[model samples]
Target: MSDRRATVVRDLVRRLLDDADGAGTAPIVQVGHPVLRAAAFPCDGQLDDADLAQLVALMQRTMRAAPGVGLAAPQIGIPLALAVVEDPGVDDAEVARVRERDRLPFRVLVNPAYEPVGEDRVGFYEGCLSVVGYQAVVARPRSVRLRAHDASGAVVDEVVTGWAARIVQHEMDHLRGTLYLDRAEMRSLSATDRLGAHWASQPVPLEASRALGFALPTPAGPGGAAPR
Candidate 1:
């Protein structure tokens, strides 16, 4: 990340800590907390080896227990640039088909970064563990090239697509002090209950965008598009 961005993240962390005034650890840090907005530190060699492994294990367990596809270290009040992601496959075939949701085995990413892979863009309603109870339509590149390290500090470079790609991007954004809300179509933002009641079957609803007074991005043709 750029130095300016890093400084902004540090400021955010300071503000959050000031507000908390030395509170105990919570199950998951929520929005408005500095940890969630601050850039996390690279974990490689910066932490005790055994301790890092334990933290990774705890993050994985917490993610699964939260019933989320991914979790970042900052979400649990740790400021290390670490995240864990896994999808145990969806049962709803239509939902799976629309989102390209598929089985993803457990994986860990440390100090991750990603770039757009192709021009194809897909819009989906995204929710977050930190920003609970709300979902919003966000268009993202359909594929990405990820560069990062695993829990053991091995390099990980690969092309990721479909829902897996979305998961990766979301977690990486956390590392960079970005949130899905920063990229979401404000008009498409809805409560989870509202989404289930009305927009459950839709892809990206133009009506919602219209009502929200924001324009959605035009879909790009098959080539590399910018990251969301």
Candidate 2:
């Protein structure tokens, strides 16, 4: 475990504390919950109670299920102004998670900030587990120089480069009550036409061939995703 590890529970903490009523009894949060979509909350002092810890667990589970690399409490309807990020890619530290990790889940965050570490920007397509059903093209900083808190309540700062940076930006937007749609600058072109023309530029897997029973052209590369 990293020295600055965000307080790991070894596996699932919920089961251990399931009967503990106060710290492990938080309910799952859903999209559209007033708490999930709130922006800019100050939870440093007011959010350390039992409900807060339970809420943290719920957010951790929700983010993992979304198959996300990191998640903020606000995204799961808890507007405590904090985020939980588990960098599975730390092992790879290269690609932006082409696949999810099977074990050793982590949540490292308290009151983290997403500051750009580099001036470079890259265009990438993004999808949201919350919005559902589609992907969009958007642009984000290729790397972000940021400082955030670890789960242990420690301030850990590192330059989040590459896909990790993307994850940070994506989650940060959620904290601010912003969605990918907020960053979408592309003209709302029809999905069918754009896909047809850009099929060769996509990186779709063969198993994902059909959308609504009709297949878009075979997804082909790094450029397959639309830029935001």
Candidate 3:
């Protein structure tokens, strides 16, 4: 059924994009959509090679256009276990160092999953394209072991750390029908403007936690500090 459904979805998305005023992108579905709340269908050979490539290309274009670090299929009204992630990085060396954020090349993840590598946790402000206009602080594992198939159906298994790990975990959560807000410290939610205006200077979110009157998990191991 998923395989047949994949064909239907691919055709539907193409038509939707065609009608999107030649922008070559589709509208990202916002939060509260049923598709975003349901577990996505696994992408195990559901799409043939050509169809898979086309879908990946469209997803990449949409993700780049949204100007987000990552995007999951459910975010676009396609409930498939797929996502694209990339980060060009910030120019400020101090900020990058504090957040452990570096240049991350664009990559496609199919049926991706991850597990925490250790007990250490770090809290940082996170926002989703689906949950537009808001950002919140969430604590997550500082390192994780990622297991997935690449665009070419090759296995990918490795340990990712720092900001990269955070990106992986966030996207994988979408495949499992979860959102950042589900795990977020609710009190720390802030409007996008307020986040930049009030908490942008605080790198690790510690100050926001303090000001917001919320508790943050302590770093349990090395390289674990308050990150931007």
Ranking by lDDT: 3, 1, 2
Can you write out model 3's per-residue Cα lDDT over 39-78, one digit (the tens) per residue? 9988866667876777777788888998988988888887
Writing each residue's lDDT as its tens digit, candidate 1 over 51-99 gives: 5666667777678778799999889777778899999977877667656
The TM-score of candidate 3 is 0.92
TM-score of each: 0.80, 0.61, 0.92
- Which wins on lDDT, candidate 2 or candidate 3? 3
> For model 1, what is the C-alpha lDDT against the true structure?
0.77
What's the C-alpha lDDT at position 67 in model 3? Answer: 90
Off by over 4 Å in 3: 2-7, 14-23, 220-223, 226-228
TM-score for candidate 2, please give it: 0.61
lDDT of 2: 0.53
Candidate 1: stretches off by over 4 Å: 1-26, 203-217, 220-228
| 1 versus 2: better TM-score goes to | 1
Superposed Cα deviation of residue 136, candidate 1 (Å)? 0.7
Best-performing candidate as measured by lDDT: 3
User: Top model by TM-score, which number?
Assistant: 3
Question: What C-alpha lDDT does candidate 3 achieve relative to the native structure?
Answer: 0.83
